[model samples]
Target: MPDAVVIGAGPNGLVAANLLAYAGWSVEVLEAQPEPGGAVRSDRGVHPEYVSDLFSSFYPLAAVSPVLARFDLAAEGLRWSHAPSVVAHPLRDGRCALLERRVQETVSGLEAFASGDGAAWLNMYGMWSRVGSDLVQALFTPFPPVRPALRLAAKFRAAGGLRLARTLALPVRRLGDEEFRGDGGRLLLAGNALHADVAPEAAGSGAFGWLMSMVGQSHGFPVPVGGAGALTAALVSRLERSGGVLRCGERVASVAVRGGRAVGVRTAGGESVIARRAVLADTSAPVLYRELVDEEHLPGRLLRDLERFQWDFATFKVDWALTGPVPWTAAQAAGAGTVHVADGVDGLTRFASQIAMGQVPDEPFALFGQMTTADPSRSPAGTESAWSYTHVPQHITSDAGPDRITGRWDAAEQEAMADRIEAQVERFAPGFRTRILARRILAPTTLQAMDENLHNGAINNGTTALHQQAIFRPVPGTGRPETPVKGLYLASAAAHPGGGVHGAPGANAARAALGHCGLRTLLHRAQRI
Candidate 1:
């Protein structure tokens, strides 16, 4: 029997398994998919020559995450590729707002829109830089992060800390309105916030926008040289070298519980793997609560809390093998790894509103990636492989609203929606359609089918709103990985620190298990002796 059985091979699952193995515990990882990485996989099947990331590509969080940094992935054949510019948002007037890797350069770019806006950008960046490292350490770790929190508080005096707290709690719209004097800075912040499900007006959205922008400025958004899967390959290599085992194509049907404790898991094929110490589930909260765990194992209140757990917006992604680069009117956009095409802040607001109202915007906000610009290895010479994605309401009905795709996400409907999204991109990148040699569209339904973790096409697993975060995550008062079941723990993105390529959730879960298994305590006692 292994010390633990991890029922998922996503970044979080793999991280937990590797940590346990490093701690002198025998760990086994089981993945439902043929390969690992979950939504972070890439493939060349879309076009025989071009490599396309099936889902997630960029890794801003991973670059700054302490947990991932400790792994030293570069030693395991993982090389990161960065573009000249971190992100570019093109306007209708043939101008683009570029967020460069340096704070001064980003400020200079913002000055073009408004005079005092440059100062505003610097002020925001300054705050982030001062507390950024400690904040990242604090937020990504387990809740009630005392030491990091105290460090951050000391870094900023009482008044400054209070003000910083207000900024973190502010919504994107409000934060932009208060800090920026021009559309340039405002649009950049809002676009970054929309990367998740939080709307511009939603509470606690300011943190997401500010963090992503500053992180991008500090470290240009990077991708693995070969593809996103390269990162996964490196992680798997590290795990194996640490004496861990990864078993793909093993679908865990249920987490076998005995006497109110998780003993092991039974696979869909009727194979049983006994876990002598712990059973960590890297699955959605609903699946773990409703499907994997029997009714007898769950508390009524916990079940109700899972029922009330909200999810992020459903996503629609399109990958293309292009003959050449995107023909953007704004020349600077061509050099950017990621591009945002929309009207402006109002455009993003309208897009969010439509999704909230269960209507798909006729002109949606699209996140376009110029993969080849970041890494030429993604395609042959003079060719490019790129992708774009946008969010929509989860439950779309046939008669949802005006300009909606009927919420069914069928093949014909998906194609029509893709056309709409292409039109949005074409507005900024004229003749964009002409550059495409082949295209693949993954609608919301298709996305859910591709990965079970993306329930209802929600790529983030669960909503990251203020109410659903921290101690309230998954459910109020159940923030830690240890669950109601004695030996079962939640280690997926559905847990705290939410989604991203960052491996905090997995590390936290492993820490919790190590405590229960007595290895961590034993090590502490031995060091003291």
Candidate 2:
């Protein structure tokens, strides 16, 4: 019997297994897919020469995650390559707003749109830089019991700690409008908030916008040396080196519980594995509670919470193998890792509203990524590999089926959506369509089928809204990883600090399990033993 059995070999699961192994426990990870990394995998099926990042590409959070920082991925063959400019939001006209790593340069670019807004932007960063590391450490670590945060707050009191508190509650739309006088600056901040499921008008979205903008300026949106898979490869290597065992192609059917305590798991293949210490589930709460555990075994309140679990907006992804670089009207756009293609704030708001109403927008707000431009090894020489993603409603109104997803779109419909996105890009990248060699489109349904973790293609696991955050996430009795069940823990994005490639959930789960087993002292003893 393994000391611990972690179900899933996604980044979080792998990280959990590694932490357990590091603690001197024999750890085994069971993954349903043939390969690991969950949504962080790369694929050549989209196009032969073009390597496509199936899900997440950029890694601003990973760059600063304390859990990841401890592992030192750079030594494990992970190389981060950044674009000259992190992101660019192109308007319908030829004008564009670019975010660069140099704070002064970014401020200078903002000055064209708003005179003093440049100074305002720098001031925001000044505050962020002063307390940003501490804030990130506090968030990405386990839930604070008011002590660590209070201590950090006291330390950073001179750096506008109270101002930061107010900033977190401010509506992103209002903050953007108040800080920047010009359309370019306001749209840039608004565009960053749209990266997640948060609406611009929502409170707590301002913090996300500010953090993303600051992180972009601090560490330009980075891609791995080869592809997104490089990051996964580094993680897997680190886990293996730390003595973590990964068993792929093994699907977990159920968590076996006795006396209201999880003890082991039954696999879909009818194999049973008992964990001597703990079981960490790096999957969605709905999957854990409804599918994996017996309904009769769960508390009445927990079952009710599962019934009310909210899903975020779905997404549609399009990948292209270009014959050459995207022909851009603005030369600066060619060097950007991320490009926001929409009219402006009004256009984005309209797009969001249309998505909420279950209708595809007439002019969708598309986020295009220049993968090969960020990392040349992603494609062949002289050609560019690119992909763009846009949000859509979670439920399919065209079909009233229980699955909530309609039939796959015909080729014409897929091409039409792709054309609409390209047309938006053409506003900045004039001759974009002329360079397309091959194209692949993935609807929200396709993404859900690819990774069930993307429930209804809700990429960030669950909604990023304020109500579901921090201690309230995934139904919040205990902010720690421990579930109501004694030996079970959540190690997925549905936990605190939410999604991105950060490994905090996994680390938190392992730490909690260690405490439950009284292995914290044993771990320390073994160090001397």
Name the candidate that leads on lDDT: 1
- Local lDDT at 87 for model 1: 94
Clashes of each: 0, 0
Q: How close is candidate 2 to the true structure, as a TM-score?
A: 0.94
Best by TM-score: 1
Candidate 1: lDDT of 32?
92
Candidate 2 residue pairs in clash (backbone atoms < 3 Å):
none
Q: After superposition, which runs of candidate 2 have C-alpha atoms over 4 Å from their true positions?
A: 145-147, 398-413, 521-529
Q: Write the per-residue lDDT of candidate 1 for residues 12-89, one digit (tens) a residue.
A: 998888788878788999999988988889999679899999989999999998888888888999999998889999
